[model samples]
Structure formats: C-alpha cells, structure tokens
Target chain A: MISDSPLLKLALTFGALSLVSVGGAPAMMPEIHRLSVEVNPWLSNAGFARDFALSQTAPGPNFMMISLVGWRVAGFAGLMAATLAAIIPSSIIALIVGRLYMRFSSQAWFPVVKDALPPIVLGLIVASGVVTAQAAVSDTLGFAIVIMSTTIVALTRQNPLVAIATGAIIGLAAGRLGYL
Target chain B: MEQSADSSKTASGRPLGKLELFTGFAEMGLFGFGGVATIARHIIVDKRRWMSEHDYAAVLGLGQILPGGNIINMTVMLGDRFHGPLGSIIALSGLMIMPIVILLGLTLVYDAYAANPDVRAATIGAGAAAAGLVIGMGLKMGRALRLHPIHLGFAVTTFVAMGVLRLPFIATIIVLAPLCIAATWWMRKR
Candidate 1:
C-alpha cells in the first residue's frame, strides 16, 4: 500500500503543483479541484467547495486550502506534507527568480511570457469559479447568490470578505426560512 | 535593481535585524485574512519604512511574475534584500508559522462540528458566494492587462479544457503553456 499512501501522494501531488502554480493559488484552483476532487476521492465536490469557502473565512496564505485537502486525506501529517510540499519547491523557485528577476525582465522573451501568463491564469480562475459553483449550488437560491456575488465583487471595489460574510448570513436566513 | 534596493535603504532599512524581520513577517502572516499584500504594504512601506513606496511597488510587480504565491515571493525577495538567505528563511517561517497553525486549528474545529446542520447550511451558502469571488478575481486581473485577441482565445480555450472538459490540469497546462507561449511569441512577431 506504499503506492497508495496518502502522505506520499500528498507530497508528490503538491510538490509538482507548487512549481506550476503560476499567478498564485487561485489560478491553480482548476487543477487543484481536478486532483483533489476527481483524481482522488479525498473530498467530494461540495466538500471541496466548502473547504475553499472555509479557508477564505480564515486568515492565511491563498494556498491554505491545500492543507484542507491534505487534512481530509491523512489528518495532521497529511496537512504538513501538503503544506510543506506546496511551499518548499515554489519558494525555492521564487528565491531563484528573486535573484534573476531584474536580469530577466529586460530580456525580450520576458515580455512574451509575461503577456502570455495572465490570460491563461485568468481563464483557469474563471474555470475554477464554474467548477466550484457547480458543486456548491443546488438550487435557484444558490445560483442567484453566485451570480449576485460575482457581479457585486467584480463591479464594485468592495472587500471580498463582505461578499462572503453576506452570503453566509443569507444562507443562514434562507435555511431558517426553509429555502436553502 | 539591486542598486535600488541597496540605495533606497531608510535609516531603519538594510540589514534589518533578524528579530525585526521575523516579528514583522509574523505579524503580517497572522493578520493576513483576505490578502497579505496590503498588510505587507502597510508594514513594509508605511510603518517600518523598510522599503520606499516605489521600491515596494517594484517588488510587488516582480512578485506577480514569479512562480509562487505573490506574497510568498515578495517575502523571499524582501527578506533576501535585507538579510540574505538566512533572512529569507526567517521571514518565511515567521510569516507562515502562525497562519499554518491557525489553519490547522480551524480544521480541527470544523472536523469536530462536521455533523451540525446549521454549520452545513452556512458553509454551503458561503461556498456558493465564494465562487463568485474567484470569477471576479479573474475579471479584475483581466481588467489590469491589455487584452489582445490572442489572449482571449487562449483564455477561453484553457477555460473550456479544464473547467468544462475536466482534463487533467497538470497535463493540460503542460500542453498548453508552451503552445500559448509560442503563440504569444508568434503574435508579437507578426
């Protein structure tokens, strides 16, 4: 069962993921979902969505969600495995990039990669939104919350915490009213 | 770039003590709720004057292009600038330790209350709402960049490939990254 050991799996999955996590954690959400939800039955889609929502309510780095995935799979040790695996490789690259960034930025190829990365990352993000929504939404109310929250956050300069908190309050009220 | 980091040192800047760096980053990490960067900007630029505003902006820009979490990269660069690799490690640990511990604590509480219906309802609602935040974040990033037709095409393609098609993300990115970069190169040349 060494092949199936959750700790090893967490280490491998996140270790590789840290490197490709361009544009930070949100950009990798699509891939994160694919692996954590589908590739491994570590958590259901709704559970994944809930975990993400939960992370937002807490304070930490954007990558904190990965810890939840690890925790679900293998508890405290799993969490450590995932978090360390996620941070170490990427941080090393970051250290190297920090050293070379100025040198690289002036080069011609730099602009191309710079120009290319944002859009793809954006696409991944929007895709993550859709995937999360599909899992979390179960009714018209849930659908409306996503639509409204998206519009409010995108159009206005409101803090995201406001939207999330408001959503939680609405959900509580809706639950009381038997609409949830 | 090194020159700027070197030259712009405030009286309090340059070789910022290991203790100061650790405590500073620890505070940043602990309070980093929605975004760590804003707090970082506050502490680094306004509060401590560790880096000038312009310098902070430059580091942030570099942080974005780097391969890790933008804030994480920012910490590394700033730490390295101040105290080299040792500083980098200290800053990172200081920034992460409390947050990681707190996240673990939250997970413990959530696990304890897993069967609670009220918690379930609210979490689901919150999840639904947070989905919008993700999409909106993408839109905000899009607004920041000048969108070419090529960028749009690739964005849509990547979205469909991953979100709709549910292709393996690692493989999808592998195939797409080079192709997208190359396509970008071709477009630029044309």
Candidate 2:
C-alpha cells in the first residue's frame, strides 16, 4: 500500500532542497545522497548511484535525480510530487527576486553578492564531486575512466556525452572480458 | 535599469512569441545533453537573437545567485522577460516536458535491465564519468573566476567543510556564505 504520507514527505524534503540548490542540482548531491540513503532508507547507496548516473545521462537538469528517487520510493505520484517540489519553490523565488534584481541592476550589493557566490558555488560543486566520486568509483577501470573523462572534458571542446558514452562502452567491454 | 534597456530592445526587435519560446526550449530540453547553458546561450543569443550577449550574461548572472537549478531559473526569467507570467509558465513547462517523459522511460528500461551483469558494469562506468563531469565543471568554473586569494580560501574552506568533513549542507552555507560575502566586500575596498 503506497501511503500518501511518504509521498508527502518526499515532496516536503525536495521542496526544502529546492531553495538551497545553489549553483545548480549538483551542489545538493551530498545531502540528497545522505537523505535518501541514510536518513530515509528509500534507496540503497548503489541504487542512488545508478539513478544519479541515469539523471546525468538524461538530457535535462541534473537535479532530475530527485524525481527518480521519488519515483523509486513511491511510483508516479511520487515522481510528480518530487519534481514539482524540486522545481517550484526556488522558481517562485527566482521569478520574484529576478524581477527585483532587474530593477536594481546597479545596486552596490548586487555585484558584491555575485562575486562572492562563485567561489562558494565552486566549493559546493567540488564537495558534490567528492561525494559522487566516492559513490561512483569502485574499481581501477572506473577510476581510470573518471580521470580520462575529466581530462577530456576539461581540456578540450569534446562533447561530454561522447566521453560518457565512451566510458559506457569501455565498461561493457571490460565486463565481457571478466574485468568486473 | 539594464533590464528596461533589454526589454525595450526586445520590444523593438522581433519579440519571441509564446510558441517560439515553447518550441525553442523544447528543443533545448531534448538535445541539451550534459549542460544546457551553452546551448541556451546559442539559441537565445545567436540563433534566435532574442537577447543580446550582454543581456544574456546579465540574466544568467542573476539566475546563478538565486536558488534552484540555474537553467530552470533561466527558463523562468527568460520566459518572464518576454511573455510575463504566462510566458514563464510556458517556457518552463516546455523545458521540462520532453525530458521528464524521456527520463521516466529510461528509468523503466533501467529497472528491466537491473539484474544484468553487463548493464551493471556499464552503469558503474557511466557513474564514474558522471563524477568526472562534475569535477571538470568545478575546475572550469574556478578557472573562469580567476579567484583571488580570499575567494580561493573560501572555496577551499567550503570544500573542506562539506567534501572532507561531510558537514551538513545548509548549515555550512549559512555559516560560510556571509563570511565570504563580507570578505569580497572588504577585498573590493582594498
């Protein structure tokens, strides 16, 4: 029996996460991993990892993983609830504050706030990278793939999807060769 | 205000109608694999000429400071800029609709292949690459900022607090963001 309560909880949790998802969805990964895996037991670590990969591969916002988690927990209704929860609150704030910022484009505090945010956003992103790498990298081959993909994506204009797809093909070949 | 200037320019030029906004974002949603920011800029600034380069950057800057997904916020702001409240709704929904359906389909496919060893291995590989993507994005953004010492310190501190120590996310931000903001203001003075 799928209870309304868990779905509601899912909505509430993601709704709160929506407000703090600075820099984008990836910034919230560590917390999202902890909450869904440790706090709620809604997903195992591996399950969370797989869903994270799915979200990454999909052509949308990285935060779409939250919806996947909700779906895993409670099906379609959970999906809708979590997706809306993840998008709505912060969007409302964006709409309101965005309008105001346009009006106050020359305010003294605006540029200061903007300049200060990038570093912090960078930090959060790095933290998310750490959390995700810990969860995702399991073997030597996986580590190598991470290093290669990171190098290629950072140093060149190569499409990231190509890198990701290459990683997948390598994994498939490795699995067939009994590397796993 | 720069917003008024951009708005007036948009008004004078061929303004984006609701359907165009929807179709444009829908296309972005479908093909914008990895990150949507570049593709969005291409569509909005280059292909469509809906916004000038400066206007696009300014809007993107504002989007970054606010909460939620940056692209999602971009959709809202861009939508509102052209079409008011209804425009915002249409743009956001367009951005989400196709991706949501496709993701749901992918999830179902993943569940069906969950037990396969090959599929599991490929997922692991994909996951590693995904992590790389995140790290690369951080490095790229950090380089772009040309971070001063203070900013670098704050960024490293944040990484330590959350990545190393595994502190709570919201609490760390609450404690650190104000300090960083003040430091930036002080740096500006000098």
Candidate topping lDDT: 2
Question: On residues B71-111, what C-alpha lDDT tens digit does candidate 1 reach at each position?
Answer: 98888888887777787899999998888788778777977
- Give me the candidate number with maximum TM-score: 2
Candidate 1 lDDT, tens digit per residue, A62-148?
888898898888888998899889888988877777777779878898878877777778888888888888888989989988987
Error of 2 at A80 (Å): 1.0
Error of 2 at A134 (Å): 0.8
Model 1: fnat (fraction of native contacts): 0.71
The per-residue C-alpha lDDT of model 1 at residue B183 equals: 91
TM-score of each: 0.92, 0.95
Query: lDDT (0-100) at residue B81 of candidate 2?
Result: 81
Q: After superposition, how far is residue B121 of candidate 1 from its true place, in Å?
A: 1.2
